[model samples]
Target: MSAGEFYYDQKVLENHLISLVPFNQDLHVSKLIHEVNTHDLLKYIPFPPFESEEEFIKNFWEPVLNAPGECLYAIIDKATAKESGESNAFAGTMALTSTSKENAVTEIGILIFPAFQRTHVATNAAGLLLQYTLDPPSAGGLGLRRVEWKCHSENAASRRAALRMGFEFEGIARWHRICPVGVSVEALEKRNGTKGEQRGRHTAIFSITWDEWDEKRPKIVALMERKY
Candidate 1:
């Protein structure tokens, strides 16, 4: 893909706590790499830490940006402007990935830097993306029918967060993916894959369909708006 090419039409999404903007590698890679490296944020995603910035760009940024339906979003916190000497800090990333127009489906992936993890950033970011991804045309959203959230079955926190964000659990897929042996993944009886010289994990699947959006969206909005 060329430097300026971007696929997703909707570029900026905002709420009370965050602004989710299309991620620009040139502008965001530096701060993002530093935070990911220092905080080791990808442990749950199970991707090993990048060896270098070039490696991060090539391995992480390139593939996601080049994919037709995928887009990375930088989660910018609306608070603490002067402390960071900016309007908003690069709090983390939220991505809409594995999109399918035919199926009208997409998945949301989140990584909240340690500094912003336990606060309202993750909730607000996920809430905004949900509203944008599933709302109908009359509501000025993508009008997609389904949005998914999947995580390693052993990652209890992730599954809880998914449920909290209004994604309904759809059962576990045993040995759903092959991952490295020691990337913070806990072993389970169903995950015994070693053929590829890597371990596997059961995947916990969750989704919210358009039919359920009217009911779910308000709950998520309330969570996002609730003051800490």
Candidate 2:
């Protein structure tokens, strides 16, 4: 994706809005950062938030709001056709980090509202995120060479979703993560340069290359049609 264009601009975020049934203001493109800082919706994921929404906005989201290599989006539920509900902040976000020599690798993770979990919302939203990451810039995409899906080794739902979406099995990273812990509390007692000591439980990595994606696209599309 070009620096100014969001997520390769291969597909306009606006276009996705058209597919959102009944239209929810929470999913509006303008409220992206606000949506992300809404901790109420993000409790599903392991990431810890700052003390308040304002704190999160100032300390985190705002800093990276214009940064390259990361793109986050709100998920819309077209199937439910419900116009009124909790605002759909970031059901999930994707990271497309720069890798070797002009190649960028993408990683995706999602957190669906409890009501929307296991429904078509996750599948459809993830599908779009994948396609957006892998599509060529000329076609309005990030043109990534590889896309990854990693999760805590024991997170079965995440693993299942990775396989379902076509990420191939890759080895695990032992003790790579731990369950959520309070960063602020730990920082107070710890000396400088020990920040890295904070850890999470084990994590498993899974990946799919563009070549693999091309091969699996037709099948995945078919499966999605049947399941969704």
Candidate 3:
């Protein structure tokens, strides 16, 4: 199948804890701005900090929205009640990027806000994405053979989460890319006792192949179902 044929019919996904929908700029920009300001969600990645909503749109959102074979979704908390009586409040963003129809593979990138981290929010959101991506085309799924999760080697939390969710460690790509430390220079100095730029990092790669998914899916489902 072609890229367009495989990705054209994007769908909304949900479970008891969270809802995943096609990202809408108008609906998500405000919440995203707040998340970015309060949380260092994009620090490990190469993306620069967002200085304004306009820059966020131009540099971040638009690129993802327009990218071929990418499906970006806004994560919403279903249990959070809003003044508008809507239980689904924007929590963060996640994406299935670098999708290849010919290879039947994709990478999952997630950015869960601070309020929702260490909770079932990330687990459920990931579970929903995995289920959608690994399900066979005949079953209304991506029919993918592999799904990758990559993060900064120094990001212990991300690496832990990847393993906890059944992604196996592949290896590290040394000096994979230059990534910002995700903090102001002062803050970085205070925390690490050195200038942020002086510290270099590597990329840790992980993956859950289709065969592994068969074994890991149930564990993930059970984890998501547990009370946290």
Give me the candidate number with maximum lDDT: 1
lDDT of 2: 0.55
Question: Candidate 3, residues 5-52: lDDT per residue as tens digits?
Answer: 225467889887788887777677777777777676777766645768
Scanning candidate 1 in windows of ten residues, the lowest lDDT window is 1-10
lDDT of 2 by residue, 1-228 (tens): 122223443233423221322112234433433444554543324464555545545654556444554444545554333465434433434333333325677567665655566666666666666666776778766677888887777677788888888888888887564444321122312556655554445667888787776787776666556553
Better of 2 and 3 by lDDT: 3
What does candidate 1's lDDT look like per residue over 1-228, in tens digits? 222343457568996567898887766777877887777666557454575778876776676557777788888887854366443488888888888877889988998888888899999999999988899978878899999998888788899999999899999988777664335344554366434345566789999999999988888989999887
* Clash totals, every prediction: 0, 7, 0
True-vs-predicted CA distance for residue 113, candidate 2, Å: 0.9
- Between prediction 1 and prediction 2, the one with superior TM-score is 1
In model 1, pairs of residues that clash are none
- Which residue runs of candidate 3 sit more than 4 Å off their true CA positions? 1-8, 82-84, 180-200
Error of 1 at 216 (Å): 1.0
Spell out the clash pairs found in candidate 3: none
Clashing pairs in 2: 1-8, 10-140, 10-141, 177-200, 177-201, 178-200, 178-201
